[model samples]
Target: MDKDTGKAFDFRLFKRLMRHTKPYRLTFYGVALAAILLSGFAVATGVIAGDIVNDAISPKDADKLLFLSLLMLAILFAQVLSQLGFNYYANWLGESIIKDVRISLFQKMLGFKMTYFDRSSIGLLVTRAVADMQRIGEIFSQGFFVIVADLLKMLTAAIAMLVLNWRMALIVFALLPIIMIATRLFQKAMKVAFIEVRAQVSNLNSFVQERITGMKIVQLFTREEIEKENFRGINEKHQNAWLKTVWYNSIFFPIAESVSSIAVALMVWFGVLQNVANVGSENTGIIVTFIFLIELLFRPLRQIADKFNTLQMGMVAANRVFKILDTESHIDDLGTVEKEDVKGDISFSDVRFGYIADEEVLHGISFDVKAGETVAIVGATGAGKSTIINLLSRFYEINSGMILVDDIDIKAYKLSSLRDKIAVVLQDVFLFADTIANNISLKNNEVSVADIEQAAKQIGVHEFISSLPGGYQYNVKERGTMLSSGQRQLIAFLRAYVSNPSILVLDEATSSVDTYSEQLIQKATEKITEGRTSIIIAHRLATIKKADKIIVMDAGKIVESGNHKELLKKGGYYSNLYEAQFMAEEVA
Candidate 1:
């Protein structure tokens, strides 16, 4: 919600946007050349019309009139062709530029740290990548090039008017200062209005996207009427933001038209007086020409204000998009190690970290997991158990201390190389709107159907999947909404298993599943963790009794570490926690 009340023309942002058009230089210049030609054609038409009145109509020469008519037709045809070239090439260049920009934006988002996504809205990002991109395209397709053509026409018309009759041109130019002042005010007012319009557009998109995504919650609580009222308020604000722009246009255009009419009136009035006083040609061509000349001069002046609005909006969008591109949120992947295989031995030594600076979530946490060992971490909520997984995966960097994999500092390995060896499944699983096989393979075609089937079978979910209507090809819909919560967790398990990682981390992976799914998941867990190092984060203490070690945490500190029987005998923090939090489940 940063309000950028920038100047009417942001030269820096303009230059940045222009850089994107560099690759399409040939097409860009071709469109500019067409704009120049269009201006020439427009001027020629007006000149020819003046000639028709004097050279063809005055003498009543039929043959001459016919020739003049054909000539006018020819000029009209050329004007049409020039316009076609200008319109088509401008749009083609614009679309090409936005296509490149969208790709870059998407790539930047992909490289950003998880913290960036945590603090940003998905809908706002979508608006930047999609709707704002189209506005940037408008700068070329309808705003910048069109304004250039109009300005050229106006300039040529002014020169022609002065050359033909200076006195009348002076009279017409008298009213320009009035219109110019209004237009200057219009540009400033519209810039502010359009910026608000774009902001409201982002707000509306964010609200609607969140509401639709969580429609079930509204329905479940029977709060439909309240949500509807909330939506109406947002929609009203969006409408009002647009109406402000419309109001500016409303005040500007009528003043522009009225001033144009005054210019036309003064031209005709002066022309008649000059003809009556015997100071000009009796043929009436000059007077007739002034009428055409006046329109050519002032019509573009009128339209230019509107086009400038488009240009300003485009610059605003470019500024926002470039801000994201320039953000320094990407994790530094400077590590030179490129090992394709890692031994799954992880160690955290005096690691202190936080999602925010100066507020540590893991206070000097330290632990070690040997290769092929299974360790379970049990803790109260907010005890920093999940932060351990985030640190191990390097989704967020630690503030102080070292995390090592196979005795080498984890930061010394290439990010992809380090992550390739580890896999994590969270309690709340996410699936894309794609086929079951595609979800399991993450759209990696190299993981074949046979491989997916084999992994699913080994993980004990193949029978459940085969029972669905499309089996392996079943569409899970958005976020796997078509599947039950336990089913979604099972899918997540299968997905992780197919990656064949040397290290696996399950964060509350079995917390939401039913009895049957839990049994199947437990079996799948045994198969996947047979030889690989595994870390299981569980709230249910019974789930991890067989783990080689149990680490109990409280308030970001590890209070105990031992075998299940040993920890029970200690009767310290772990014993008390088990009695209060897990004893009822054990009894049931």
Candidate 2:
């Protein structure tokens, strides 16, 4: 939601927003109907009051007074019915529109490549989806439709004044330009205030969400006081942004009220002038009717500035939402091929990639793994090992080369088809706050609880799961904080195994585990990789000693490729790494 778009009400953006309501045009028409009916009621109210004054009270006609009073009551009841319908449908439509918008946002995020998420904030996106979305809904419930209805009422009242007495109508109309100028100024000020408010809210949400999610680190490092100070600054800025809108309201409302009162006083003075000059007979009925008319005319103008603030917020929110909707960072699913399975052969040929432009992480590295073979990739922290796995899974696009599965370009397979055949267990295992079985199967009903249990049994973690109070039904809580790191890894391994993937990846799967957990993980790894082609990325040299082949990487290039014995016999990078890294284990 940028502030310097020049045109405050961009027609293109509004047109796009209105398209979301295309499916609910009936609701839109209904609101318009209410506006028209309300305007008619406003005119009728003035007319009935004038009639009661001139035709009944002045004449001392009791029967006429009761009839007109009852008539006014009926009009009031009808206006109330129209108002209820307007409020209900307007709010319902707003909610319905936001539901669709939030869903679209989530679906877009789901399809985005990891690169987009790498540099984006979780909390900022949440604010966009949840908070900004609500603002857009308020455009209907509290902003645009309501303003339209009130303006319609004002117009009807003005027309009635002109019909009743053209000269007096011109007197009240003369005061409008003053209030109109104030409203224009108020709207501009509010637009700027809302932009700042939205930005501050996003910042606040990002700061709070990050701090709360990483509260452990904050406490571990005793950064609580520092974070509190930071939060205070943000909260102050947020409060200030809101107060700007309030400050403008303070200035604008009184100007509108003064102008309204001046217009009424002007009309009363005109009536007395007519009496004094003998220009016309005194018309108390017209004066009283015009009093009601002035309120209808100026009251909406007074409140329109406040409603415009709501509208401004919605426009700003729409800009932010449309920014996401217009993003093209999602990976294209251009592949025409569909496959139920693959032969498990994988290759990366002259592949190059980077998360950021002009900064290569993988430098045209090439590797191959045969079907059913256990291949291990050993590398230092920045050797692009994980990047390679990411490319294989199509989480990123290769810069200038090709990745293939079973001799077919990986891009030739549809994304879902390709991903279904491969499973990854990363070092940082993530689990939803859900039952163990649901986490393992990821809510895929095709993989039954029995299938999950059998897979866990095969991986030798069934006994471990059975020990928990709820066994497979145990809730792991957010990110599986309830379990130890090693236990979370076990769950990841079980999740991978149950998918029965043709290709399995364990990226530093045993890195952060106790010896006992590592043993269980190793045993599970052996069982899971029995038939499927597995790629193991590990720092511990001993973990991959039994691999059919080992590829050793330095920086972004492969420096050695061989079995453990051959790599040791060659006295190269692998031999030196083994000596420096795992010599203690070798001694043990």
Candidate 3:
């Protein structure tokens, strides 16, 4: 957004972008060779035309003129063939590069720590992958190719023109400084405009995506008009940014064209003066040839200016993309040791963590969970209840202490292996738009239908699913919108059970369900947690009443911890909270 920073256009980012083209080296060379051949053929056509005119007007040898005409046709035909080949290969290379880039970016994004997603918007991320990638592709396919071809053509044309008539060529060459100077001045302005456009686009996308995703909240609050105004403001800013870019481009191209036109006019005037002074004969053939070559020279110059505009836009997009790719993950896998199997024993020793340093969310807390034990963590909202589960899962890194799994520091194990042993059913469940069976057997392609049915039956959702028109084959809409909240939670529970992990984590898994569904979930939880270490983070006091050990949290620390009856007898924070909730229920 700060375009005035001298570091706006980074060459290092351009170098990184170019690395994606490594796989298409052969195509690059092929296109370059084709451009050369095409340029030569184009210049030769002009020479042939001049010869034909001179021969026909003077009644020279017909055979010479005929040969020249045939040669011109052959060159033109070859040029067309080469252009086609070049276009095919260039397009293939550009698309292939874009595909590879998108894949790498996606993989890198997946590797990023969860905190990255916490701070970034889904819309901005999606824009980088979709729209920005397309812009970069256009730069490579059309912009880069045009620049290359134009450079070669301009160089070749200049040389040919000089060879034909050095005096006329020099007159045209004098205008080269104007283009160079104008481009130099326009480059910074264009880069600034493009960066503004890119920022505006990102902001607009974020606003639209957030509003759409939270439309229910808007409707509930009756703030649709407010949201609309907010969106309009962002959209207007984006439009203004684009208009500025358009203005720069409009001024740039016409100015470049005028400079080129002046160059051509200068050459024509000088050619006439030379003929009048008797330095050269007034040979219409030579004059026409010179005119054609000058046109060829200026044509590519104009193309270069156009390509520069596209290149600037690509730079802006790439800058944003690399900014994301360059971020270092705070949580990373360290290969100090590898454990093939974990006993599901977890211990936290003097653990501390926060999204931001110096603002601790979890203090120097310590706890232990033996294998095959259920530990319930309960707290008010924002008491770091979810943060504890996140740390145990290594979604975030602890600041000053270590978390051990089976008495081994979790960092020592491969992240994938560590996570493979644990399954979490979040309070807010998300299901892919797929059949019920496919969602359950997520990791196994060859899971039997009987096994899926068995898991569903164990979760007590089998009967409900069977009542549906398609049973296990029922297709879920996006985010499982086709199903009720309780149904979605049940499916998520089934998914966790099917994974057969050694440790189960249910964070408010039953909070969104009805009383009947909660009872079903409680039964399913007992079945699933049977010989596995389980951790439950819940706000509903009743859900954890039967937990083997209940840990009460307040202000990011464990205030009271004991079994249900013991905590009730202690008459502390846990007792007060339970009493308040009990009174509320009794009044209801």
Candidate 4:
């Protein structure tokens, strides 16, 4: 959960948001110019109404009245056009700004270290990227520029009032202080209410997203009723948060309306008295114009309070988004080396690392794999098997020591160039909601459809894929849920094979497959690892029997290192783990 800063106006945040508009400055300036025109047109319409009553009608000059009526209609037409430009251009600018911000935000998220995501909520991040971004955009579309135009109109109206009759103008302003103070109070109260609203929105999004994504787990354990009850509680909180804003609006707008009525009544009372006394230039026309001016002034007083709420919500959203943009959790790609044609040799020299501080997962582990060698790392469930893979790919940085590839520190290579030579197929294969061919190629135009088919055939999964309804064109759906676990694993193998990486990683890759797919995977494994350095992490000791080296780990340290038969001969940690972890699979 995020803490509320309880600020009414955050200038630093405001400036940060304004910087997004730099790319669309021309549209921003156009919107500003339209606002100015709108204010001017508004004041012109009010002044013309006054002239129609005072000069055009009083002398009963038919020609002058006809000309003035036509002029007023023309002004109204222009006002309509200006209003359209203001609304359209403002919204255009807002959408454009949010589009750019979302792009940057997505790019930033893509660059963050995997550990950052490990501790962050996917649902809450979705809320920030989608819902909160909309609110930030409303700052331009419905909040900032509209308020500026309204304020300009009010200032113009106030000047017109003073010029016509100073006494009546002073009477109108007598009630102004009361409304101003009420507005100030309303702004503060609504700020707090809206902050609560934003917080609840994120909570609601997170809850709903998690429940929906894990609905299978909920139903499997017969927890649907309990989950629904939990959701109802969250929904209630969300409703209550919104209702707080509603309650504030109900209380404040009425006070503003009462103030507006009082001002109108006072203006009418004094204007009538002065007209009767014949002391000043008080006429029916002046009183009529004052009515227009009063509406122009008091309406914005009511509306500015509402717009201020919009502005406050936008500021809150900006603060949240900027927090993500300011995060320094991205992986450091400081190395200038961009080697694409290198021998596949990997070394971990005294590598130490932790997912959390002072609780190391990899404790001074060291290993070396010669070019074109196949190595298998076997361990119990929490024996830091997967951590080695993550560190090799640089998904998480090591706390101390060095990881070298081809005699160069892994950190001393450009990230993309380094990762391009490496590929990993995990036990849990993730496929996008696209066709099988696209998933295999990863939408890489360089790998043609023919290339994908050739790789799948060479890997021995071509028959299995062709047996499906659409074969290569089959839509895997989200995370390949439509396909069986074995099928998904085969797809992962094909994906890696097509990339033709110099280094391959298989982390329990064939553990989920059935007997037939397991045979296919074994054949694919042999073909793919022929000319590349391969790292295999498997609990099935039989699969790694022919490896060039076998490294057995326990509690983050390598306990045994030898060929499979040699480790078995030693009757040490490897022999015991081989019996404990793989004997059941051998029996089945």
Question: lDDT values of the candidates?
Answer: 0.89, 0.90, 0.82, 0.90
lDDT, candidate 4, 37-99, per-residue tens: 877788787777877887888777788888888998998898899899999989899899989
Stretches off by above 4 angstroms in model 3 are 2-10, 270-282, 336-340, 446-448
As for TM-score, the candidate ahead, 1 or 3, is 1
What RMSD value applies to candidate 3? 2.1
Ranking by lDDT: 2, 4, 1, 3
For candidate 2, the 10 contiguous residues with the lowest summed lDDT are 1-10
Q: Counting only residues 3 or more apart in sequence or on different chains, how many pairs clash (N, Cα, C under 3 Å) in candidate 2?
A: 0
Q: For candidate 4, which ten residues in a row score worst on lDDT?
A: 1-10
Instruction: Show pairs that collide, candidate 3.
Output: none
TM-score, every prediction: 0.97, 0.98, 0.95, 0.98
- Error (Å) of candidate 2 at residue 274 is 2.7
Residues 338-428 of candidate 3: C-alpha lDDT, one tens digit per residue: 5666789989898888889799998888888999999999889988888988998889888889999998888888888888898999889
User: How far off is residue 172 in model 4, in Å?
Assistant: 1.4
User: Candidate 1's residue-wise lDDT over 1-588, tens digit each?
Assistant: 436574788887888888988888999899999988888888777777878888888877788889888988998998899899889989998899999999999999999999999999899999999999999999999899999999999898888888888888898888889888998899888888888888899989999999899998989999899989998998999999999999999999999999889988887788788778988663278777788888888889888999999988888888788889999998899999977768789899999999998888988988999999999999999999999999999999999999999999988999999898899999999999999999889988789999999999887899999999999999999999999988998888989999999999999999977899899889988988889999999998888989999999988889899978999999998898778867686677
Best by lDDT: 2
